[model samples]
Target: MKKLIESLLRQALSALPVSRVPPDARPAEVDVERTRDAAHGDFASNLAMRLAKTTRQNPRALAEALIDALPGHPAVAKTEVAGAGFINFFLKDTAYYDEVARILADSGQYGRSDQGGGRSVLLEFVSANPTGPLHVGHGRHAAYGATLGNLLEAVGYRVTREYYVNDAGRQMEILAVSTWLRYLERCGETLEFPANGYRGDYIATIAGQLHEAVGGELRRAAAEVFSGLPADEPRGGDKDAYIDALIARARALIGTDAFRRVLSVALDDILRDIQQDLGEFGVRFDRWFSERSLEDDGSVDRALAALEKAGHAYRRDGALWFKSSAFGDEKDRVMVRDNGVKTYFASDIAYIFNKLARGFDHLLYVWGADHHGYIARLRAGLVALGGPAGCFEVRLVQFVSLYRGGEKAQMSTRSGEFVTLRDLRREVGNDAARLFYVMRSNDQHLDFDLELATSRSNENPVFYIQYAHARVASVMRQMQGRGLEHDGRQGLARLGLLVEPQEVALMKRLSQYPETVEQAALQRAPHLLVHYLRDLANDFHTNYSAHQLLVDDPALRDARLTLSLAAQTVIRNGLGILGVSAPESM
Candidate 1:
């Protein structure tokens, strides 16, 4: 409908005489937008205001000329030059009636578009390290990313949902050593666990599995393991150094191959857990790209080589450095340290190169807000490697603070005290979890109120939206109980009977679904869709509360039913994108 209005305005502008509106004064695109006030009409455009300055004519006069030139269309009931220069378009009642018919006909496919132009987008998100189970924070990323992916896909983008597994480097090593220590304990060898090592009970579970797989063959005596180890953090030593030393000592005792086995076991177990958790949350990825694979395939070396070839790399203080500052970063970054170990940034660069090599027109990274500083360096690295600066984008999701009964819920992943995504989903349900996770802007801190999410009330947006869907179903069932079948054909034919204010409002809201989806996708804002759903649900509920659908008048009853069904279809489609279920019975 917006397109139809825009097209009419564009044709009107083009048909105008050059003397009144010059070729140079024409806009590349018409700007038709929904009016906030019903008195202003269904849709309005500021084309005249935009062209007035260029055409050297009064905006109101230009608006009048534009309106006069507009070709007559059945959908447009009238066009008025309103306050100053806006062209307000009052859509005909039949237009909305046709929209209701279209909604019923399209069903689940409604509100989708081909606006993406088939561009390939590699959306990498929630690439939280596989060292621990995903927590409440990761749950937000999962919901936001998954919904964003669904939105983009709905708009015809070839979106590849990816989870980059940080399965390499110090963190994974710490996890391996942590698993080994726990395995040793399982083998009856008591040793003090490192302060910086993973201490989650899940690690102990993995350790038990390891013991079952290899018995005590991979275990060493506690004395031998901690005999000459440096003081741990609890003993007034650097936790990072202590953990690193423990990892080395474990490798020496178990041998390099056995150490790799331990690392692989821990990595696979935790990765599997994360994959399962996200999958159960309705967040599936097209690929789980491994950081280890980047090194194993020589992509890291190749990426470094590319930097060096482009004169963006230099050696200083026995470390290979990339001149990231040259491309607008605050400072240069080290790619490889003095110990010949590559930094996580090195793997990130390789990952970027790998993504580019795969032919993605755009690369979007969903990262934690704390990683804001890393964006500049990563973009610099991409540009240093000759990738287009515009191709790289980052969206930082702020922290999610869980609250229960108005008290903050504290969490720490390393201490094994954090609320896992599984726990959250179990507590509030996947539908509520998904909806609440994305109810706010990604960059805005979210206080996920557990009480509100679980409450079966109108205040809960998820429940409210789902209820709107179920209300329509209940109405249909009631109609059936009264021995009246919903004749969709007859309902569609009698759409003209739906002329009440509430009915018109609901029809208008339904028509905005496609626009809402498109706007949310383009803006990378899932919160927009959430707010839209809330408003849409409110419209449906308002209409339902005021109007009686099962009336003695067959045509009016079916017309109202048709409108309700359309609302239900749109709510279902929106909820589906957000990974929230629209239950028939809320």
Candidate 2:
């Protein structure tokens, strides 16, 4: 209805000669908003008011002119210029009913269109460090990213979901140190732990697994590990302390340099655990790209060189700095320290290049909200590297607060108290978890209420939408059990009989599904689908509570069943795009 109205308005405007009113500078948007009062008409738009200033006339007068120019169309039965130049169009009574036929005709393909024009987009998200298990924040990101990718694909953007692993940073080094230290503890080596390191039982589990795999085969320890000096200072606070202790032990038994080899055993364990833990969360990335690969392949160095040559970089404090303020940043950033170690921002620069080189038309970074400041730096880096600034984009998601037992769920990986993605999924089930995570917008804070998500009642979206589908299936089954027959062809032919106001209302809601998908995909908003599905289910439930689908009245039965089937198809499609299942039975 909105598109038809907008198309009509555009056509009407195009017919006016520029000589008459001098073409309106402001473009018009035909928004078909549902009327709060039936007396106002069905879908209302402010096309005339929007055009008033451009046409140099009073809004009411412009509205009257727009109405006069409206062509006769079957879909729009009447157009009235209401108060303040609002153009409200009453959809034809038959048009509402015909949508039911269209629904049955299109079936599952009802809400999908090829609007992407073959553009390819890359979505990178949930790239949690391998130092520990994925926590609740990453869980929200995984759900949002996967659904966004799915939504884009539905609307025809060639999409790739990626996870760029930062496996070569200080964090990874800390993880390695922590694991080796835990190995020393298992081997009865006495060493002080670091003030800051990864804790949690998984570290020990990885250490034990590594020890079992390579117990006596690898020898030496003590001073050899601690040979790196800071032996006088506390090594670390968590698992890294344990690793530093083991390195000290290695240095004691062998030498300073050989202590580095001890990290291999720890790194292997961390990698294995990280893979298994996230794999359980249903977040499989097309790439687990290593930050190390960028440096190893000279990509990071090359990126720095390009930025330096472009005057986007400068040497300061014996370190390389990026002049990000030229593009828009609070201040310059360090690309490399005097010690020759590249900054994480430098890695991001290389990583983006890698993504673009793979042929993605656009690169999307889904980062936690804490990294909001990094946005300007990344954008500036892309420009400094001689790449178009439009190539890279970032979406910072606000924190998700998980509540259970009416108290805040405090999460810290170092204490092993954080809620792992696996734990959240196991408790709430994947469907509910995914739904809850995306229930709110990305920029808004989310309180993932555990009790609400676990409920199997209609108040719960997981069950509510599923129930609509199952109820429809139940009706279809009743028809089949009664030995009645129908298919899309018969359903479309008999849909005109579905004339009840409730039936027409339900069908009208179904007709809006395509636009909902298009808008949601365009805005990269999956919550819109959640809202649409809930509303669609409300319509279904209302119709179910008031009407009968399998009556002795064949004509009415056929019409109702067709409408029900159409609802089922759309509900399933919407749910499918969110990686959710619409069950035929609860």
Candidate 3:
């Protein structure tokens, strides 16, 4: 209905004389919005007021002229020139009736549109390092990113979901050394683990598997492993330095080949576990991009060469530095350290380059809130490499703190004391986890109340919405039990009988779903859809209480059932996008 009105307004604008309104005065896209007050009209637009200054005409008079020129349409009952040149349009009841019919006809694809024009998007998210199992923080990334992808595709965007594996970093090295130490412990070698090592029970599990793979072949005596190691953090020394020294000693004792074997075993086990956890949670990626691939494929070298050739990089303090400060960074960043190893930023720079090279029209990076500072430098790298500024975008997801029994659960990946995504999912179920994770804006802090989420009462948003859907199904089952069949075609034909206030309100809310989906997709906000479904459910519940669907009159009964089924269809479609289940029974 909104689109039809916008088209009619455009026809009216085209009908206006060149002397009265010039081509440049016309808006590129017509803007017709639903009015707040029903007395004013159903929809309103301020085109006359917007063009008054440029055309030097009275806005009210211009509005009247535009209204007179509007094309005839059945959806629009009437048009009025409201105060200060506002064009108000009142839609006929048949307009909403047709919308309900459309909803039934389209079914699951009701609210989908081609607003995105099929532009390719590479969405990289939840690239948590394969050091340990994913914690609660990464759950937000997975849920948010997956839902965002569904929303984009719902609006016809070509979206590719990606997970970048941080397999080549100090963290990976730490995980490797940690697993090796545990492997020695399994081989009857008593040793004290480094303070910076990953202390999760999973590391010991991986070591047990490693020992099964190569029994004592890669293990050394405890004294040989820690003979000359620096003092650990427990001894008042730096934990990072001690960890680094421990990593070096591990390599020297086991040899680089044998050390890499330990690293590979740990990496494979952890990566496999991460994959299984995410898959079970319904979060799947189109690609698992390895950071090491950037180095193996010479992408990092290519990126640095491009920067150096473009004069955006120079040697400073015997290290290669990118002139990021010149491109809005607070200071220049190092591409390679003085020790002749490429820094993590070098991988970041190359990763963006690689994404662009893959022919993605846009790069949407979903990063943790702590990565805010990296946005500027990464964008600078993209711009320096001749990529469009608009092509690069980032959405920072805030931290997730889990509360159970009125206490905040502590999370530390290295300390191995954290709530994993799998743990949360197992407790609250995936439906609640998926919906609650996105119930708030990505930029805002979310306090996931487990008590509310698991409760069966109306306060639980997920349960409430699902109940509305099941309630409709219950109505149909009752109809069948009473030996009555709903005539959908007849009900659609006699939609005029649905004139009750509650019925009218449900139809109006149904009309808003398409707009809600488009807005949510364009704004990258899934919470909008969440709120919409809640409101829709509330309206449905209100209507269900006010009127009985299995009434005596067959025409009214079918009509009411048709409306109820339409509501159920929409709820299912919406929940599908959120990766949530819409059960037929609680």
TM-score versus the correct structure, for each prediction: 0.98, 0.93, 0.97
Cα-based lDDT at residue 78, candidate 3: 90
- Tens digits of per-residue lDDT, candidate 2, 1-586, equal 5677778887776766676456545475555566777778877878677777676678887777777888889988788889988988888767766776676667767776788977888899988876777788988899899888888888888888888778776676666667767777777776555656667787778778767876854443644555555433343334444454544455556454544555555565666666776676566677778888898999998888878777788998999998998888889999898978788989988887777678888888899999888898888877776677787778878898889877878877678788888888889988898888888899899998888889889889888998999998887787788898765566667777777778878888887888889888888788999999999999999999888788777777776787888899989989888878888787
Question: In model 1, what are the clashing residue pairs, if there are any?
Answer: none
Model 3, range 1-586, lDDT digits (tens) per residue?
A: 6778888999999999998898988788878898888888888998888879788999999999999999988888898998888999988999999999999999999999998899999999999999999988899999999999999999999999999999997888998999999999999989888888889999999999999989979878898888877789999999999999989888888899998888999999889989998899899999999999999999999999999999999998999999998887888999999989889999999999999899999899899999998989988899999999899889999988888767877777777888899999999999999999999999998888878879999999999999999999988988999999999998998889999999999998999999989889999999999999999999999999999999999999989999999999999999999999999887
Identify the runs in model 2 with alpha carbons over 4 angstroms from their true place. 24-32, 217-280
Angstrom error of the Cα, residue 264, model 2: value is 4.9
- Give per-residue CA lDDT, model 1, range 59-114, as digits (tens): 99999999989999999998999998999999989998888889888899999999
Higher-ranked by lDDT: 2 or 3: 3
lDDT for model 1 comes to 0.92
Of candidates 2 and 1, the better by lDDT: 1
Instruction: State which candidate, 1 or 2, has the greater TM-score.
Output: 1
Per-residue error (Å), model 1, residue 212: 1.8
